[model samples]
Every structure is written in C-alpha cells, then in structure tokens.
Target: MSDLGALFYYLGIEVRQGKEALTLDQSTYASKLLEQSSMAECKPCVTPMEERLKLTKASTAAKIDATLYRSIVGGLRYLVHTRPDIAFAVGYVSRFMEDPRENH
Candidate 1:
C-alpha cells in the first residue's frame, strides 16, 4: 500500500536505516560534548545518574562557588537533551542556582 523512503535527517540527528530495525543515538555530539567538558577520561557508567542522591538547599553561612556550581548544572542541562536519564538530577541541581548555599 505504501512505502515511505529512507530518512536522511531529522531534528539535528542523522538517520540510518537497516534491514532489521531502527537505532537512535547521539554518539557524535555526545562525544564532542564529553570532550568539551573534559569528561572523556571519566569512568563510563551503565546509568546516567544515581537514584539515591538528593540535593538539598545549601546553608546560608557557607561559602558557595556559584560560578562552578552553575557551570556544572548548565552542562547537565545540555546533556539532558539526549540523556533524559539524568534530567531529574540536573533539574534538582538547577533549583539551587537562584540561592545557592555553601553548607547544605
């Protein structure tokens, strides 16, 4: 009845078709992003984020590294696009950006 030809590209992602199935991946961009963040040498994990870790509001009296913390969380945000596995962790950390504390 119908045959939709091969897909070339979509939404910044390239499409590759084979006989058996369709596979989705962001390998190229993911590699570049990892390298840019100096995480190339980091250990590879089966999961994108830890389930038990919880981020709480920091304390007011401690000294907070706003720039570094924000940068870390920002990177996480970008990573979330392809790796929604870490979206919760990234979003959790982002909540503290407005008033990051040093102690907590």
Candidate 2:
C-alpha cells in the first residue's frame, strides 16, 4: 500500500509526528474514562498512587459496585497499550475486582 499520511489518532490514542520523532498519547481516552467513572472533576495528581501505599481487601470498608470497579479497571487495562505509566497502578487495583471496596 501507499503512505496515507501522518497518523493523528487511532484506537483511542493520539499520534503526533514530527521531523525527528513521533509521540503517542491517550489523553482523550483518559478524559472519557474519568467522565465515565464520575471523576471528571476530581483533582489531578502527579503520581497515580502514593509512594509505598499498601492496598488490601478492607473487609470493614464500605462495599462498592463490583460492576463499576470492573468496568473502570477494564478501561484502564485497555489504556495500558498507550499509557504504560499507569500499568502498575491499574494492575494493582484490578486484583480486587471480585470484591472491590470503597478504599480499593
């Protein structure tokens, strides 16, 4: 096939091509995810998770909607293709899918 042109976006990831490099990002996907999770207005943080933060199945914590948690995690997993920075955090939270708590 012939070269179509510089790719700008594909599969939820944005593409920016320059003379010496190409950049891929998922800001749109992330924004949509936040909206879907009802966290669109939440404050942004420099790090996905706190340093040395430990998460466990808090039996005493209030229960959350398993479906919502799973859906969010699933979206994050998909986003990993372009945003590996969040892989660890997403994977960590995904571990509690079966019984996610409010603190998860």
Candidate 3:
C-alpha cells in the first residue's frame, strides 16, 4: 500500500502518536455527542449508572422520539469502541430502542 500520511483522525476517533507510545481517543466525538444529546453542560457523574438500578419498560412514562433515541443509541454504540466503560450502559439503553420511553 502507498503511504498516506501521519495518522491524526479516523472514523471519528483521534490518534496521537508519540515517541514512547500512541494514544487513541474520541474526546471530540464524545463532546459532539454530548452537544447532540443536549447534555454538554451537564455535570459529570462519578459512575455511569447507579449500582443495582433496575430499568423497566416505562409504560406510564412519556414516550420519546424513537428516531432521536435510536440515533443517540447508535452513536453510543459507535463510541463504545473507544470507551468500553460505557458498553454496559449503552447496551442497557439499546434494549429499549424498539420503544424507548422517557424513563428508559
């Protein structure tokens, strides 16, 4: 293959090359996702989810836009590649994509 150039960014992931080691991150992608979810200014939590918190189908809770929810979930799934810490949360939320509710 032909040499393209120095690796900087690819598929929404940022690449940092150094003499000692290389680093890959999705900070920009994550920030954009936060902006998309309207939580850019939201406070950061120590944990992604509360321990032993159960999530059931919110039959009584108001329903959210399926398209938007799906889009957010999809983005989260993609982000999982660079952020495995959120895989559990993303997978949990993804379960409700078929019919996401406000409580979900």
lDDT scores for all predictions?
A: 0.70, 0.90, 0.90
Any runs in candidate 3 off by more than 4 Å, and if so which? Answer: none
Q: Is candidate 1 or candidate 3 better by TM-score?
A: 3
What TM-score would each prediction reach against the true structure?
0.55, 0.84, 0.93
Residue-level lDDT tens digits of model 2 in 1-104: 99988789898889999999899898889999999999999998889888897888866789988899899999999999987888999988888998999974
Each candidate: RMSD: 5.0, 1.9, 1.2
What does candidate 1's lDDT look like per residue over 45-65, in tens digits? 877667786667646567567
| Clashes per candidate, residues 3 or more apart or on different chains | 1, 0, 0
Query: Between 1 and 2, whose lDDT is larger?
Result: 2
- Model 3: lDDT equals 0.90
For candidate 3, the TM-score is 0.93
Clashes of 3: 0
